[model samples]
Target: MPKPNEPILVALVLAAGSSRRFGSDKRLFAYNGTPLLQRSLVIPIQLGLATTVVLKPTDELFLPSLLGCYLHHPLLKVVYADDALLGMGHSLSAGIRSILQSSKSVEGALVFLADMPSLEVKTVRDIIRRFDSNKIVVPTYMATNGSLKAGHPVLFSRPWLKQLQKLSGDNGAKELLKKNPENIINVALDDKGIFLDIDHPAEVPGAKT
Candidate 1:
């Protein structure tokens, strides 16, 4: 867990990847009139002052378009990842490093994806409700009768920052998630937003509609 003013928990939105599947700027795609990327950025910023974004080195053209039009918020700040093509692990590492590099005073980082606009701020607020000195919390939603679907807006406590920053390849926090099940406290939820991510152009319409 992190101290409130200590800037312990920062929102790391990985927005550097090219949306090859969508064939368009998935980050800028509008949902209910607001760009999905902008909403992603806003969710964390509105919750904490330490919210930061990770952006891949990209053409000045499209990057600026979204930043100005949608992601432009006073609390939102940008950190650059040099190689966006190295997959999600690189972007995740870059985002955590950016904060660790700028200030060691940070407690932990909370991670979210760019295309998941279905998640609510209350869901995130609930996830952060149990901030502590050394525990990781993850949200699990009820899937069906007695079944649970696991996902994130993951809360990484301070002790795991080193493990998270050392991540590579296509692997995400799953490795850690499996290794430390006891440390994980399930933040129960039932919303589909916990699993909704725009992977294709068709998903965009379904999520928004």
Candidate 2:
């Protein structure tokens, strides 16, 4: 729970992409017997953070799966991105707009990818715990190639929303991070789940069940 007088914070899950690279609707793809999008929502729901899910405006086939999560999770808000095909950035901007419009008290938004089901609940919690009004909190780790890499979910302070809402194309928040590298507070973690995302069937890990 947030401290008294603290502005509301939300987790914005970007799930609007058409999954052209995967050759299928990866958001609805089953991973470990659960839809991948739902898996991504697990940590957000468990932490009781207000979450907003962004999807394509024309998308209906995945409503059954999405609705199931929404019905059970009162903190979840669903919004549609009419220009989702424009790219992930547009989807992100749309989700942020919807969040601010609906929740006037929101001061920050933590961006989470819908295809990344391996992210642990603790990772999400720690990120939220470190969020500040002036600095962007990012979770990072070293990839298999030995280079350092930043991973989600990234928390952007309220001050970054104007630029965040102007984002477009597939870059997502990369441009913002690049232009404001000095404002970033990197939180290094031991979990490899931060680096795992399913973009193709071959990349899906074995189901626990």
Please name the candidate that would achieve the greatest lDDT relative to the true structure: 2
Candidate 2's TM-score? 0.92
Residue-level lDDT tens digits of model 2 in 1-209:
56787646888999998888888778777888888888888887777788898988776655876656564568888888888998999999999888777866778999999988788888877887887898899999877887778898999988887678888999999988988889999998877788788878778877422
lDDT of 1 by residue, 1-209 (tens): 34546436777888887889888778778787777777787777777546667786664456666765434666677877776677777778778877787777677678888888889888888887866658887888987687878776888876888778777666667888889989988888867788788878687664442
Off by over 4 Å in 2: 1-7, 144-146, 207-209
Which of the numbered candidates is closest to the native, going by highest TM-score?
2
TM-score of candidate 1 versus the correct structure, residues matched by position: 0.88
Q: Which stretches of candidate 1 lie over 4 Å from their true place?
A: 1-7, 59-61, 69-72, 206-209
